[model samples]
Target chain A: MTATAFQFDDVTFAYRTQRALEGVSLTIRSGERVALLGANGSGKSTLLRMMDALCFPASGTATAFAAPLTEAAFQDDATNYAFRRRVGLVFQNPDVQLFNPTVSDELAFGPLQLGWEKPKVRDAVDTVSARFGIAHLKDRPPHRLSGGEKKRVALASVLITEPDVLLLDEPTAALDPASRANLVGFLAREPGAGRTVVTATHDLDIVEDIADRAIVLAEGRVVADGPVLAVLHDVDLLRRTHLVFEHRHSHGGPPAGSHGHMHSSRQEG
Target chain B: MADQRYGICGCGRGRRGALDSLVLGLVNAEAYALDAEATATRPGFLQSVDPRIKVLALVALIVATTATRSLVVLAALFVAAVALALISRIGPGRLARQVWVGVLIFSGIIVLPAIFLVPGTPIVHLPVVGWAITLQGLRSAAFVVGRAETAATLALLIVLTTPWPHVLKALASLGVPAAAVAVLGMTYRYVFVLIEAARHMMEARRSRIVAPLDGRERRRMLMTAIGMLLAKTFALGSDVHAAMIARGYRGEVRLLHDFHTRPPDWVFLAIALAVPALILGLQP
Candidate 1:
């Protein structure tokens, strides 16, 4: 069996006064491209953060690469650095990640932090800048980029680190239609061999194209774990989990892909 | 690399001014990052020069110009400054528009009692206040104004030429402590993101303004807006942090080198430094 990439055995968490996660037992294997499907406040993002070792679970076991998830796992700066490089996380909004004056610096930030030499850093910056089609944007201020461009820049920033696993939170939110299509196509086709990618998204259509499998979460526990075509459209289960949207008419068809977005039934269409 | 790339920068003063700004700011060794950029007239110039040299040069010039009370020397330094700015391709008008705060330094000492203090002959009487304008007073005022104008011009020229990165890069190259460069680099990257976030925060609040509030509620409304902005800023900070982590940053900074000093750079440096060094060396 593939070694566990990320696993939590009865993990639980609380945010100040509210309980966020409880008894969430799951094992995600290496190279598993799973889409994290959940309603708002279902502890999806918190779970992704735990995998990256950003926030610790209040109780129970969360492990990555067979190492028990603990403060000691990140006690050494090198360890924390390696952890960050190993599991990258992209936010929904580009405003959170891109803080540089130009595209090159923003892309280079990660590699230099990884302690690569100057020449290597520069090369990496250039490569990723081109990869995201921002090479011309090398000198442009990141904030001025269009919504799609900013998103691409943000992704390039993380990919420069060449992470082993990618955790994306709402990888597409607030993007225009063409850009969204571009992002979908890119994510679906990019290199992820031997690397795990778990994306938390509200747009079920993305889950159809990019992800091979799905993990459904609602109210902090996993409800369904199966292929993307099956779990996403399970309307009765989603409604039971409080995740069925007012727009979803039925499930069980060509998946909840973009074409079926507010229309409800994909079978009818 | 592209010649026409800077046209879209929107500084509106043509390319020469922009390039001068990119270069001079580096010479003056201005503090960098978005904060400096926000208050700064130009940052791209300073980004190319070695930070330590720029810092030292700025400090040295400021001292040489400000230490004395001689109109003739002050006038010479001011002329030299304008000449440098012109050579750098920064417009005189751009310099004028750039340094409003700098003029206040001369104004602060405008009413000084140099005439009363100096053991020299009085020159002319004032028309309005009937105050005696002594030779010493005129000399001192000229010195102060000239000194400030020269100093301001030099600094402003530096700012116009340098970008924030080059200043920091120069600092790091010049043996600024590692932690300092690391912090500065990180913050500079974040500032652009923060500004973008700020725009969103403001818009989010603005969207809720279906109807305008009365005069008395304006303060409270602004306070709420500020509070919301701060809260969103923090949230964005965390999200950005996560995004950076995803990008695979490990807290290292490596600045790209835009210049390897040509013989011309040395000649320029020699001329630039020689004038000030000679002034200080051959002081009366």
Candidate 2:
């Protein structure tokens, strides 16, 4: 069996009077690409935040790399730094995540915080900016950029740190079709060595291309866990979990006189 | 449209005017952002100078201007600032709009009362108020306005020439407190976002208005929006802080502000610093 990269054993958490997650026990193996599929407020984002140790569980233990995840564990600056360096979280909103004025500074922020020398930090920023195709936006303010450009800068800001575990919350939300395709293609091609990519998203079309395994959450509980194709193809399960709505529609058939016809069917509204 | 009694005017027209002014506010905010970008991108002398040197040189000039009580010296500094602004491709019109309107006019108003209030030799008697203006008072008022104008021009020049990031980085390098610098950077970046968000909220509210709101009703709606915005801001602040912490940012904000000073930068700094000293030295 693959070594467990993250283990959440009966972890429960609440926000004020609302319970966000309940008995969320899950074990993710190293280098596993997991898709956290759920409806809004289904605790997908909360789960990812827990994995990054940004939030603590009210009950049970959340462990990453065999170390217990807790506020006390991160009380030590070095331990917190190491944990942060290993796990990078790309926020859903680029506006909040991108606090730096310029794109270059945004990317260099993490490396600089890690105490890398000036030259090394500059090189890392340059390399990452180039890879993200934001070399032209190096001096441009992040807030002034277009939505897609801002998203790229936000992702580059996190990826420049070269974290081992990449946790993204709704990574494709608010992106144009082309930018969305570009991001999906990038994630599919460059999962990177020894890095685990867990994306919380409702965009099921790219799940097959980006994630191998799927974890479906419904009302703060794991509804299903299986291969991406199996979970996504099971329309009944998807509808029951509220990951996808039951739409009654069909493309009817292929072009006239074609060799084969095409059609799709599902539950009624 | 209902007749809304505004604080300024008691009529429905006042409500319409308020809506128009709200739109204008967004335009004004955008224009400031545009000016900052335009001045930084302009091809000019100060645009190419190193920001660290630029900051220190301009600050030195301000200090020199404030220390010298000589009108002649202050006038010379003001002229020098205007000349620098012209050479830096920042239009005289733009400078007039920003510095003259923003600083000089306000300073002039404040100093106007001083001319009549201060005890000095009578120069000219005002026709309306029947108050004699004193030479000592006039000189003192001119000195105050001149010093403020020169300092404001030089400060605006630095901001107009240098990109905001470099300016903040220079401040950080020049021994500004780390926490203070961090706040400065965050404010510079997020303040615009907040403004844009508020603008959008206003636009949405305006669009949804089926009928004009009375003064009290408008105030209530505005209060609700403001309260919601504040609540959102608090939540967003926490989220942003969390995002920063998740990326290994532990209080100290370290940035890679790379600056290379050519020989010209030193020459410019020397000239900039010397002019102020020369002006002060030639003072009586």
Candidate 3:
């Protein structure tokens, strides 16, 4: 039986006066690749935060690996450490995530926090730096790096710990075309294999490559949940959720077979 | 569109607009960071030494420079500082801009009055005021100026040779509180982010200026920009805390301990300590 990695039951979260997530419930299995698709402010990031135990549900239950994800649950150091080791979250903004002074330190931060030995931390830093092609940037401060480099360092920092579940918030939001392709290609490759990957993004073009399952959110609610192709083919749901829209386009060769195609809401020409 | 002439209202001749200042500040910060990184990574004498020993030794030298009353020792120490900078690939022009010229001008102005005020053997008389320039005042001014320049040069060497993270780590290793070191490190890391945000804000403001902004309007605009920046900084801070927590920070900050002291580092430390001791011993 596949182990359930995360289970949310009617989870509702609010930020002071605004409702960020409402009655959002989903179950993600271990080793399954999933994409949380939504427009901006559609509760995608809030849900990922809850899963990572950074925040708690206001009125409902959320669990990771069958453990209750509450503030009190995380109060226990042992449980918190174990959970943090098992799950890693890469923030949407690389600047926020890359807070350490240097790329090497940032990569080693997680292992050190988890009480890994000094030698082990050093080895992990070296391995991950080389794997991410950031060995040249080990001594460089985070602020000195470019956007793509920062993003790579941020992801490599989290992946250094080899977490079982990886949570990425808008992993490709601000990347350039080549960088976006590089990141998407990397996500499609071996690092994500056998890890329960939950990526929250609004980009549709890379969804098929990064995820097998797609969970769509609209106005803080799960509007669609199915296989990747099924979700992509649901034009009505996609349009309603503001992920994509029907646009008229004609090929230069002929206008006889011209048909309206779905263009991503965030698509840039 | 408003007339370009009128658009330059508060930013007239001899006046610097806030937007220009913001852009200039950003550029200066970028240059400083690049220069520091370039110098720190260069293969040089001090750059090869361990950060902890370098920090301790330079600090000892600065303290010795301050405590010594001997003009000969102060001048020697200042010369030694310049020699170290030269060996460490720091050019004379860079040293002048980074330390010497500014310190000399500022300290000169401060000590100018002392030349007329201090009681000692009269050396020269001012043509207009007829105030005597005493020998004691000249000696006092040299001591003050030399101490300031030497101390600043030593401090700058530390900054220019070692990477900032290594320096902070060395501080932690030397019994500085981990929380304080962590705060300093985080501040250093995030200042660049804040500067970039501020630069973008200033650029957006500059792009939208179709009409002339008077002094009052410019002040209001500046105030509004500051308020917005504060709000954004608060939000960024909250998000950064969340990121930290997500990464298992768990309140007590932990950093990687990877510093190793070599035999050369020890030798450098010995020489650094010996020079200070020798200078102090030669005092009087």
Evaluated on chain B only, what are the TM-scores of all the candidate structures, in order?
Answer: 0.65, 0.89, 0.91
Please give the TM-score of chain B in predicted model 3.
0.91
- Highest TM-score scorer: 3
- Runs in model 3 deviating more than 4 A are A250-259, B1-15, B279-284
Q: List the residue pairs that clash in candidate 2.
A: none
Q: Candidate 1's residue-wise lDDT over A9-75, tens digit each?
A: 9999888978878889888888988888887798888888788786788898888888778877676
Top candidate by DockQ: 3
Model 3: lDDT of residue A143: 90
Residue-wise C-alpha lDDT for candidate 2, range A32-122, written one tens digit per residue? 9999998889999999999988899999999998988999988998898888888899899999899887888888888888778889888
Q: Rounded to one decimal, what is candidate 1's iRMSD?
A: 3.4
Q: Would you estimate the TM-scores of all the predictions?
A: 0.80, 0.92, 0.93
- Per-residue lDDT over B112-176 for candidate 2, one digit per residue giving the tens place of the 0 to 100 score: 98898899899899898799999888898999888888899999999899888889889988889
Best by lDDT: 3
Comparison by lDDT, 1 against 2, better one: 2
- Give Cα-based local distance difference scores for all models: 0.68, 0.84, 0.88
Q: What's the lDDT for candidate 2? A: 0.84
Candidate 1 docking category?
A: acceptable
